[model samples]
Target: MAPDDQPAPPLRRRGARMRSAVLAATVDVLAEHGLAGTTVGAVARAAGVHETSVYRGWRTRENLILEALAEQLDAAVPLPDTGRVRDDLVTYFGALARLLATPQGEALLRLSAERDDTLPDHRLAYWSDRLDRGAVMVARAVERGELPPDTDPGLVIEALAGPLFTRALISGAPLDATLAPRLVDLVLGGASAPKPGA
Candidate 1:
């Protein structure tokens, strides 16, 4: 048994490494090429893995792109906990605005808007999960009394995000640095304002 005859490492280790590489490469490719241009061959080449390996693991290009985009979005927009709801909202939405202004982020927004019968449910699920995760900030604010108990976290998040999406995906408006604070103030203003009866 010569040292050269030693078998390769186990499939688990190789698979894990390949998965990481593929996901990272997929994000880069998506950023560079957008959804229409991204392909398994491009991602595999970027990842230094065989196209068959990517297909075997992800089963489809849509799945691979969705997973990569989801991972990137989660990392890029984290919920801020500054102990003050206003500051938290400003920081969180500010990061989101910045991300949405980038080429990669714009590509993701366009990808989400595309009507793909194969990914309709999956895309909706992804956005629903993101809204839920973002709503935690408002939920915490309510628990801390920064916002009224009646505040709808999901609605608050949607209100803050809707305009940004429109600007990025529809009107092609600029996502400036000042926009997040302004939006946070507008949404939180109504949320924190005293009720008519109160």
Candidate 2:
């Protein structure tokens, strides 16, 4: 049996490792240099891989960077499950605030400001999932008799989240520890359903 005739081992392990490394490098570059700076060459150099490999695998630099950013957000953000709705919201949003305060978070915010059309449609779905999670919190509270039975969960979430985002992005205000609860309180202040006959 000639050596060339032997079966070749699978490249699965190496491929997975390289994929992880390349994605991490993309995130690091975006954090340090912003989206415009994370060229394929830059990421390949940072990841210690050949540029051709990245291009062959990811097809485009924009796709790779967006996937990398989405991976980070998916890993970091989770639905809150605490028994109390307000506490759950505060905790959930507090983590988001801290993340948004980082360089990577700031870079993502810049992406939002620039209105990059290259961003995939799935990213919007991710945000919608997050909003649904907030709705779940409101639904749970309603089930527990904490709020009115007919309360609009989406409205409840928007009221709770809008100010937090405003402070983090538009207003340039610090997301102080107390801000989460304050926002929750404001949202909960009118967390009731309209009268059935009204």
Strongest candidate by lDDT: 1
TM-score of 2: 0.77
TM-score of 1: 0.86
Provide the RMSD of all predictions against the true structure, rounded to 1 decimal. Answer: 5.5, 7.5
TM-score of each: 0.86, 0.77
lDDT, candidate 1, 17-69, per-residue tens? 77888999998898898777789999988887778888999999999999998
Per-residue accuracy of model 2 over 1-198 as CA lDDT, tens digit each: 899996443233258788888889998998898867889999988887788889888998877976787777657767778888877878877777777777787676556455567764655765676778768888998999988998999988887667766776788888777777766776776437443335
lDDT, model 2, position 191? 38
**Cα lDDT for residue 112, model 1?**
88
